[model samples]
Target: MIVIGIDPGIARVGYGVIEKQERLIRPLCYGCIETSSHERTTSHRLHEIYTRIQVLFAEHSPDEIAVEELFFTKNVTSAIRVAEVRGVILLAAEERGVEVVEYTPNQIKLAVSGSGRAKKEQVQDMVRRLLKLEEIPRPDDAADGLAIALCHINTLR
Candidate 1:
């Protein structure tokens, strides 16, 4: 099975693709789609996100998509912007007929690191180990995206 995992954000949305079979997981691709903070309009940024995600869906041809569920405390504005980006991602997946699954941060950490309260470094280390990478993906967003994918694959087991 091929899965695409997303860590949604307005300024920088991260995505990872993985292929799983017979208890093995392989990283296919991972990267962040960045939008400029200097943009004068939020709508343009959202449009860019939607268009880029649509292109990614086409390129990856994933069987399913897994996205991190929104979680916020003490920053309603940030949460709202993230949620907007997530909405575009979900819409793109739905339009393409891809199955979508949502996971929480704790759920992802637990599945990837064996603990719900695992540290970022721990999860990154485990992802690198599981995928046999030389180093963890950069900028944190990519790492989180990989974690989301790993969480889905682990849950299936």
Candidate 2:
């Protein structure tokens, strides 16, 4: 099975693709979609994210999409923007005929690090170890994206 995980945000949307065959899971690709502050409108930034994610869906042909659900944020504006980004992501997945699964931040952390209250570094380290990567995936968001996917994969087992 091929799974694409998303860490949604307005300015930067992180994504990771992984392939699972039976008991094995391997990384395919991981990166982020970044929009400039000069985009001038929130809708435009969302459009950019949506368009790029659509391309990713077409290219990767993922069987499922695992997305991180929104947790509380102190900044209401940022939270709303991120929620909008997540909606765009779900729409893209629906268009591509991919089943979408959502997981909370604590769920991901527990699945990745065996601790719901694990620190970011602990989860990142676990992601690197589980994926057998030489280094932690660059950009914190990308690593978080991978963790989301890994969480889903572990849950399936």
Every candidate's lDDT: 0.93, 0.92
What candidate 1 gets wrong by more than 4 Å, as runs, is none
lDDT of 1 by residue, 1-157 (tens): 9999899999899888999988778999999999997934889999999999999999989999999999998999999999999999989999999999999999999999999999999999998999999999987898889899989989888
Instruction: Score candidate 1 by lDDT.
Output: 0.93
Query: Largest lDDT belongs to which candidate?
Result: 1
TM-score of each: 0.98, 0.97
List model 2 lDDT by residue over 80-133, tens digit each.
Answer: 988999999989888877899999999999999999999999999999999999
TM-score of 1: 0.98
Deviation in Å, model 2, residue 101 alpha carbon? 0.6
